[model samples]
Target: MKFFATCPKGLEPVLFDELQALNVEQPKQTLAGVYFGGGLEAAYRVCLWSRVANRVLLEFHRGPGETAEQLYQSVQEVRWLDHMRPAGTLTIDFTGQSEGINHSRFGAQKVKDAIVDQIRDETGRRPSVERLRPDLRINVHLQRGEASIAIDLSGDSLHRRGYRLKAGMAPMKENLAAALLYRCGWPDKAAREEAILDPMCGSGTLLIEAVLMAADIAPGLMRKEYGFTFWTQHQKAIWQDLIDEAEQRREAGLQQVKSRFEGFDSDAKVLNTARDNARRAGVESLIHFERRELSRLSRPTGEEAGLVITNPPYGERLGDEPTLFFLYQHLGERLKADFAGWQGAVFTGNPELCKMMKLASDKTYKLYNGAIPSQLQIFNIRQRAVPEVVEVIDVQDDSAEPAEPTVVELSNGAQMLVNRLNKNLKQLGKWAKRQDISCYRLYDSDLPEYAVAIDIYGDWAHVQEYQAPKSIDTVKAFTRLQEVVAVLPQVLGFPAEQIVLKQRRRQQGISQYEKQDQTANFMEVREGGCRILVNLQDYLDTGLFLDHRPVCLQIQQQAKGKDFLNLFSYTSTVSLHAAQGGARSTTSVDMSATYLNWARKNFALNGFAETRNHFIQEDCIKWLKAQKGENFDLIFMDPPTFSNSKRMHDVLDVQRDHVELIDLAMGLLRPGGKLIFSNNYRRFKLDPQLNERYEVKDISRQSIDLDFKRNQRIHQCFELCRTE
Candidate 1:
């Protein structure tokens, strides 16, 4: 008999090897199914032993099914009466489509009508249709104009494995579980009596599948039924012989299958279902199940080098995506610590979340669990090989101890660059941690050769390389940039993805106002008891200014119960701080609608979404001048020094406009209220006229952060109020 074994989409190659092992005559592969020449006995062997095959079919004939009449005629040519009792039930597993038959149920009905009509005409009796557990399941597939008909030798899908009692939230399909294990080299490991573990084994599907494969227990044997046994062509002696042989080997295989299998789940009830699932499969003794949290996962004592494979939650449930990143990171760190020399596989739909693992995997397979596309990333959990940090620059005078002979070779210039970055991070990183700071600038072009700023945001690093001067050689400049890119990930211990690279160039015209990207990605970072959102990408500048850190802190201390106005509020980071400090009302004015929307998100993120927090999208100068009756208790005006924005009626030069801008802001200030004006113009001269008109105090020294001490001219600040 010529037969076909249907498996999951990505398991074709796996099933082919399985068919070959079952002694089929040269199995030929096809989409989602494989074809082979074999008799009833060989088919029975496959139906019993193949772990990946979903169905076993005995193809009867192929012909045109472009029309209903033609489809019926094609299905009628098969000997239906021979495969089913005259009164036995039948069902059609119709797949694919033809131009004439678009509806699968309609096509199946037509095919069923043909079989019943033919069988009744021959013997005056027809088989009844059974949708569930049919004695004989016929497979009908029509593609274009051709139709292929077959009798399903195995009922239901072989993936059923007859073990699962309960499938947990987002349960992985059994066949996909098997494919993951196979891809991770479990079968080879099983032969060596190695161990297997699934830390997030929700209902223990992977654990049960592994035990069944190792024990040589036929997945089909658990269920005492087959589509072929009742068929007229089935040879009882041949079928019994296959079963008898499997039973004999099963006893011996049980002794040979010494590989230990265990599973852990956090939910107690779900863990119980996994226990029940194993009991039903009769491999409960071959595996162990426990209600254990993922953070506590560890290899069993005395376990040999083995495989750690799991299908953790993909965080597709609700908005749990971000939280799973930490879980993957923790799992990877624990695996590296405890399970060195073992193979690992993580099956997940969210490839972006895989970045948290920090392990490199060269082999990845694209597979599908139902409609969800996923990747099975395979990696070996061995010690990460640390490359020797080779020193390229001979900065040492003969007195310096020879540096370890391991640094990556680089030009003398690049070597000096890495050395300076290393030294800066050593000092800055220590102090930042001592101050409980998760985000801080570690290096700032301390060496002219490395004109890049390295800022640590949580576990990620953001590198902003200053555009080289025109006088510098273009090729050499690019080479240095590449060297910085290579050294940061190595020296700083961050994944390349975690390190965002952006070229910072002085913007002219309205180019600075344009959106670089629409990603709008923002992350909340803490500063002085308030959470502020920062976008490392999609902009020329990160939303939060590192140099203005102290200014934001001071705002929080002074903004209780005060009506606050934030002018030129790029992302409103300072305004958010004011709100956190119990500000009664806040009005943030900026020309860019994009920044206003970003500020709104920051408000929402900080749980400060009050009706009184207003975002005005208009030119700050225009908005300030339009305020006639309003007087604010407190105000922050941080204007750009030179903005030639087309959105503005007149370009702003802080040196020329500071007097008017500070005066307009002072006019809106109520009695005892303060106005803080700041700018980043290196040559900025605060009009002496403003100092004469109001009580002005230079707080520039007070606003600069420890990290920005070297670049004191980065920004300047002043506190102005109406003269009494």
Candidate 2:
């Protein structure tokens, strides 16, 4: 008899080896499971002993099911009377698709009608359909035009294991846990009497699975029922004989077991569930469950080498991702500090969090937990290499310095970036110092391959990589980005921790202003003789716009005892400059309360009284329209290219709304007052009627500084005044 065993997607090789070990002949590999020429005894053995297999299936029939009629005819040929009585319960699990049967449910319904009609035609009775614990569970798979039909022998998806009465949030399936253990080489460590540990073990699924595999206990022993239990063809004596033999081996295996299994979680209630699960799995004494925080994780007592395996939360459903980064980082740090010389494995749905671990994985296996694609990252844990101590001699004379700078070796791409950075610093550095500009753009995609904007804000570097085109290979782009990050510290004289990295995609709505991280790490930087605070880590923007430096300075230079109005005033940087330039009073308006609060801080930072410099939290368009009659000598309106914030009454598209925005702002301007309008939309065009009506001078070139001269489209600035 030919049989098939279904396992997780990424563990086909492991399952193949397992079938061969069980003496199944001619095992062949497929997408999710393995096919083998194994008789009833071999199939039963797999059903009883296999740790990773989800179900053992007995092949019933195989044929083409191109059309719905063909599929029904093929299923009807299985002789339904031979497998189950007509009075029994039935269920069909259909997967894949064909030209005629495009839906799994429709395909399953056709297959079910075929079996029920065939049985009722001969026996005068039809089996009732049962989705759970059916007497005859049929699995039909259609690929291309072929349909492979089988009877599901092992039921309840083998991952149930008859344990885990209560599972924590987002618990991993037991079969997936076993597959991850196989990928992490846990069996070898167990054989050598090594220990296993899970720091974030929720409900003890990993611990229970490890103990069951190591103790020679059949995973299906505790199951009360299977698909074959009610089938008419089930051989009672043969199954009972296998069960007795397994019971005997389990008794002996428990006595000989020496490997330590331990699980730790922070939740006491979940720890109780884990202990109960271990007890139900019959390994309570062999495993230890403790309610210890992950931050307090340590190696098992007296164990030198073992495996530290865990399935940490992926932050997909429950936790915030930025906080989870620290969790993964702590897990890696704890493993390095406490479990050196051990093997470590982490299974997570979010692969991006793997980078936070900072451990080099020996291997990574892509698997799935249900529908969520996950990764099993395996690492050979070793002690962190101690830094070599070097004695530093203090120079007695301040003038005495190294005769020549040390040149470090780098990759070709990194060397190219280094040379470009040096050239830019040589030219822009002198200009920045001469102009007393502390914040400036050093390089903006100078090398097309390194498509990142490097901005220097005092001692820190904020690098924003433009999202590469889809035509570029993702891995190649990432490698180039890595080279850029590795080369920046050496080239720019800043430590790695001082550099903040972010990826910039085209902004939608107000998402560009959304906080990326909670670390409000602000640093003071000087520009245009005013003190400004820039947060490099929290948002995509650094609270200060480096490209708008010249424009803000122009506003300050023109504002002397003149009332100023700043609209869309992000962080109020321009308003602060205007206030410092001796503006009589300044009013800053924006839609974000966060920015308005930040503007309040900026005014406070500059020692400007909040009573004099007003920060209004309202939509700039609505605020401008609501003003009955207002007069300001200088009004600066710099709106986003587009804003569809939920707080806004309507969307603000610069190209479509610039004319109305300029006219509204001009209404608040006095007779001779200037309305400096600007936006970063590259294709923005001022209305010709506005130029015909008012005196408009395009100062786009003058608004750009020496650093941003190469990118003339950074922003378009126009000064509008009344011509009457």
Candidate 3:
């Protein structure tokens, strides 16, 4: 009568919404799980239609635990004979959080022993443990000394769905990949005249899910057995009725098949796997599989509008940054040149690679592949005319020595200037980093009035302070940025996306003599369950720094039973880690409501509890000024380099305000509390002006990364504690 549907950490809300849409009533959320009341028919329906759930579990019993003896006695109390015959095979799976149980495997063994012992004592025979396949599958969950037992209603994880008979290397699970497609707004209709394409379709999970949805085919139709079918309580007529209803729905959907679905993979073997998978799903006639490299892809004929969904490779496995960049550059050029009227969806673990596509995306959705948080960026490409190039005359180079170098007119006009800068980026970047200067002035001019600066860190570059010409006839700055990026791979041995561009715009209503201020644009990327906010192809100053990745992991490890407090929390990175780690509750405080809203999106993206985690839109100083006694067990305090928001009581500077902030934060910690304080202002000096009331330890060594190897002191971190 009662069941639980289990999903990955960040997909609970998606699964819950899906269940509600199916009219499954009264679904309750749990930690990394959900519970609902349903019959055998309902359970079977959920397995068939629920796209987000990993597995469906049927609850058997819940009782208080006394000891190992009590747990064994409780196991024997269940009427196992009602579901499993004495000669049938049985298996037990255990998950424990209670102090009474030290090992989940051991607990499972004990429960299995009790079940067989009871059956043998009563009937003279006991079921054997069948690991591969079993007649009955039981599940046990122990938390805070209480145990809840259940039967696994789905024989295998619901992701299997029985449709995938063949798979390629590193194939995504069917359920999760399906959820991603659904999130992208791919409708469930066959004859909509829209097309779906996966450029890098390893085993074609995305294409297969699309075809199944378009045909209104239930995923559970291919599976031969369900856990509920083995139960004595399973009513044949009820299951028959459910199957009949599903068949009617499928038949109604059969008339609507008008769209085309296809996938392309460079590997021939993977294409074969995709074809086989389609055949198993009975949609082989409706889907196409092709073997082609990304550069060789061509637009489908007579299609004015379509959706191009793809999962491109990140450089993590390839380890060649230059090659990766070229791949991205080619990909961008292909889309721009061929698919002029198509809307595209690109899913990538690397933000840098996404930038190489060159087209501006209208919407971005965040999802996870295992622990890696990733973005699914949607692009709407429309036909537009290319603008003609223009040239400008002599200007003085301000940075050059006396007898100022004259800017020479070049043949290709403005195009030559863009090409030269693109070439210089690669040449000068390697030279500057080798010289140990992270930031350097590239060009400065007052006549034409363009000041250019570059920040080089790791293998990436950030172009800052590039001002567009004020003349109304000048090309748009975005067009210039795209031009520079197109030649980046050739000049710098890096991809176009790896070179981030920041624009400088003149302030309105100001004197013509006033200098323009610049602001850098950064995109957030998700990798391995973590959200990394940074300027793609830019230097180390990511909006959300990755150096604190280890710190977030540490918080995840220590989150259970603790109330977490994150101060100056930009985008709530630590809070996400705490929630994923199973913390009781979390409160994130940041001065910027904008960053707080972004943090909330990250939580929603990862399926964290919105109510359990609160984002405070107030200055941490003001919030701290209003607080009194020690409360939080785990705290993260990372301040900005310098900020002067009018709503704040005082100007916030990390270097100048570290001591006072540390003291105030220490006073708010509970006994044995752990506080992590960090800052990115280079050449920072710790204040020696404060008393030693708390123990402080440097943790910067644990935060450095290979990707950020060029900057040795990019950020500094400290572990502080109040003395007992």
Candidate 4:
């Protein structure tokens, strides 16, 4: 007989080793499973002993299936009576697609029809389809117009170890947990009687699997049913002998095993569930479960070093990435402080987050937890290095004032940058104070060598380094950047960490909206009369555009008693100002859901009712084109220079599409209402024909604020009203 054991992707090699250990012959590895020639004894052994196999299959037939009809005929040709009776319940699992069979359900339906029709013709009683616990689970694979059929020997996936009656959030599958242990060499550690620990062990899957491996317990012993139990070829005597042998081994291993395990989680409710799962796995006494935070993680009492393995949250299931970064950092700190001289392994889907751990891993193994590509990083917890301190000399002065600290040496270029920054601050600081502006640009590429835009939000500065040209020396540019960062703390009075640094490259399409980091580090700053939140670290542009300050204020001044529409309303700061100006209704539209969500939070922050204010998340052009009636008294439009986002039906170029966009906005405006059109494209030219259709006035000068006066062409603005 031939058999196949299926496992998760990237576990083929490990599954092959497992089949070889089970004494199966010619175990050949495939993409996500292993195939081998084995008898009933070998097949039953794999079903009962293999920890990582999701399902074991008994190969039945290989035939041609060029079409759905051919597939039905191929399935009907199989000797159905040899495996299952007519009255038995069965289910068909069809995978892969052919030119003729594009849908899996359609293919599965054909296979079912073939079997039921054959069974009914032969015995006048067809088997009923049962989704759960069927007597025979038929598996079919169609590839390149060929079909391979098999009977599932393991009724449910082997990962369903039956011990986990309930699971906490983002629980790791039992087989994936087993694979992690095998990759981390937990089996060898168990032989040495070394303990195991998991700091963020939700529901104790890892701990339970560790204890089972150490105790030489068969993972399938807890399962109550097998797919072969009701099969025609199943021999009760052969299976009973294997079961008896496994039972004896289980008893002996339980008595002789000496390794211990511990699992900790912050949620007490999840700890209760972990304890219950451990009880069900029959390893409750050998493992300890506790509710503890990652910060308080320490070694088990009176135990030597062991293994620390955990599957922390990977931002998809539980918490956000920024918080999870601290979680990983604390995990590393605790491991270094308490678990030195031990081995550690972290399994996570977000591999980039492991950089926060601050420990060097010696090995990394790629694995998959379902569809999520994951990695298991193994590291030895060595002693941490001590930090060197710089000694300072305190010199007594006759004036009795505290001696000045060491002055940081700056290069000539850095001093030039310092002079320019001070000059701008001295001139703009008083103007900003008078205008009550908390967020404004201090310097925009003031010096040619140090090409960067330094903007201050309240006290924290946001510095964006423009990508240097190839002619500049890379090392020189880097040194200048270091000087710029070094001088900000002294010149701006904000700490270095508070100054968020980002590299600005020319962005295309909606890449500007793509997250630079998952750190949602938002700070609230006062802009005009309203409070606006800006995330300096997470994107190329902050939530609020400093150049648009005047545009937003202009909308606010003219927005009273008007229904306002804001197109391409990135974060809707202008709409917020309009709402503050007592607009009867405010509508904001943008394609990026992230920005729309930010706008919603801004509205909530300002205590604006969602009922009066509307935030529509759609492409502005598409939404505007879909509208038919006049709806707004005032409209403000600021569009990107160019966008070819996948979500948009067509690419948008502001210069080519501005006339159409303006016309669309005007179509929705009341006869007497006006439209304020704006774009950051420096060389934008208004369509000559638009001037003949409406009264177009250039407000570009009025829209340019004092801080932006140095860069007069930062943006262009216009006011368009119908000429009756």
Please report the candidate that would top TM-score against the real structure.
4
Error of 3 at 687 (Å): 77
Over the stretch 1-724, how does candidate 3's per-residue lDDT look in tens digits? 8989998766777788788877776898876767888677678789778877877888878876547877888888897888789988988888885566788887898789889998898899988998768888899988778788898878777888787877765567888787777766777323456887777788888988887777777777778787766766667787777788778877776567678887887566778888888888777887788766564666788776677887766645432343354355456666777778887778777767777566898888777767777777888877543311111111335586533222333335345655545555556566555644333323232113224444443445566555655662355545444544454444445544456665644322212112223333334344334433443322223445556766777888888778899998877888878877767678999866656665765564343434467889888888887889988888988887777766577878778788888888888888999888888777778765543667778888776544344455768888888777
Preferred candidate (TM-score higher): 1 or 3: 1
Candidate 1 lDDT at 402 equals: 38
TM-score of each: 0.56, 0.57, 0.54, 0.58
lDDT of 1 by residue, 1-724 (tens): 6889898787899889878888898799999989999677788888888888899988879998998999988888777776788888888889888778989999999998998999899989988988887888888888878998988988877778778857778888787787788787787899999999998787889998898778877777776777875677777888788788878877888888888898976556787888899899877888888765554678889985988888876667512554455467656766776888888889988877777677888689988888778899988887743211121111335685533323467888878887887887888788777876767887788878778887887766788989999998999878878888777777877756557888888777577767677776656576666555677777888777888888888998899889999999988989988988877778999888777777765664444432457889898888878888546899999998788888899888888888888878888989889999999988988887777788989999999877777778889899987788
Show pairs that collide, candidate 4: none
TM-score of the candidate numbered 3?
0.54
Among the numbered candidates, top lDDT falls to 4
- Angstrom error of the Cα, residue 149, model 2: value is 2.3
The pairs that clash in candidate 2 are none
How far is each candidate from the true structure, as Cα RMSD in Å? 13.9, 17.6, 20.9, 14.9
- Please write out the lDDT profile of model 2 over residues 545-569, one tens digit for every residue: 8888888888898898899999999
lDDT of 3 at 375: 78
Q: After superposition, how far is residue 639 of candidate 4 from its true place, in Å?
A: 38
Candidate order by decreasing lDDT? 4, 2, 1, 3
TM-score-wise, the better of 1 and 4 is 4
Worst 10 residues of 3 by lDDT: 385-394
Q: What is residue 608's positional error in candidate 4, in angstroms?
A: 33
